[model samples]
Target: MKQVVENIESKPSTPILGHVSPSDVECMEEIAGENWNEDCAVYAFHSESLFIIPKQRNIKLSLATLKSEIYTISPIRVFDQNIRFAPLGLLRWSSRSRGLHHGTHRMHNKNQRKRLWPIWVLLEH
Candidate 1:
């Protein structure tokens, strides 16, 4: 007896609903740049940080104070200034621990692991 093997092709999955358009993205960028009201300016310590909120919430809250109060919202953008790399501190959580690469151990390579030393820099606004 002989067995036959067949190859099958798969179709693309359905597109996500409410796809964002260029215009929508532009509008959101414009809205995000807004300073809001005087009250908000006082509370907004980080001007560079962008707070993302839904259209409905933005429309409902006329005052920036109220909008600022609503902590729950979509993910906000992390400004470059807000990000830092400290070699000796908790800030280096994103970086790998200082030592040989895990693969190097298996390979028995004694050469340097091309260690990265990230210096911490503080800039004044």
Candidate 2:
């Protein structure tokens, strides 16, 4: 966790251009392709792939392919649970996979229960 924080702090922060509302599923589709879902958006944010343009107020996201380039419609890469930080399969488990409310799972005391909040990411349509 310290390494992750160090890595993030080392890079210059990118200015946010605009917001993506929950209603804008279309924009999410463009980035994640067909069959896009909440997991896709979550993955993008977790992987730090979304960025803003120099002169544009709109935000854009890019998915990496096997060649380590921005992905396009026709050429899908190995984007699955196998990738680090990718949402794990519903039934499968692995060292890199984190379950829903991962932090809460370790809390055995009832008083430690905390309300889980939803994550909201705004995407342009």
lDDT of 1 at 109: 38
On a 0 to 100 scale, what is the lDDT of residue 67 in model 2? 22
Quality of model 2 by C-alpha lDDT: 0.31
TM-score for each candidate, following the candidate numbering? 0.17, 0.18
TM-score of 1: 0.17
In model 1, where do residues sit more than 4 Å from their true spots? 1-5, 18-51, 55-125
Q: How well is each residue in 1-125 modelled by candidate 2, as lDDT tens digits?
A: 35443444544445434443333444643544444333432222243343322211333543333222221111111234342122212222221223222321121357766654332222233
lDDT of each: 0.28, 0.31
Residue 6 of model 2, lDDT score: 42
Q: Write candidate 1's Cα lDDT for 29-52 as tens digits.
A: 544343322111001212222222
Backbone clashes in each candidate structure, one number apiece?
A: 0, 4
- Itemize residue pairs with steric clashes in candidate 2: 20-122, 20-123, 21-122, 21-123
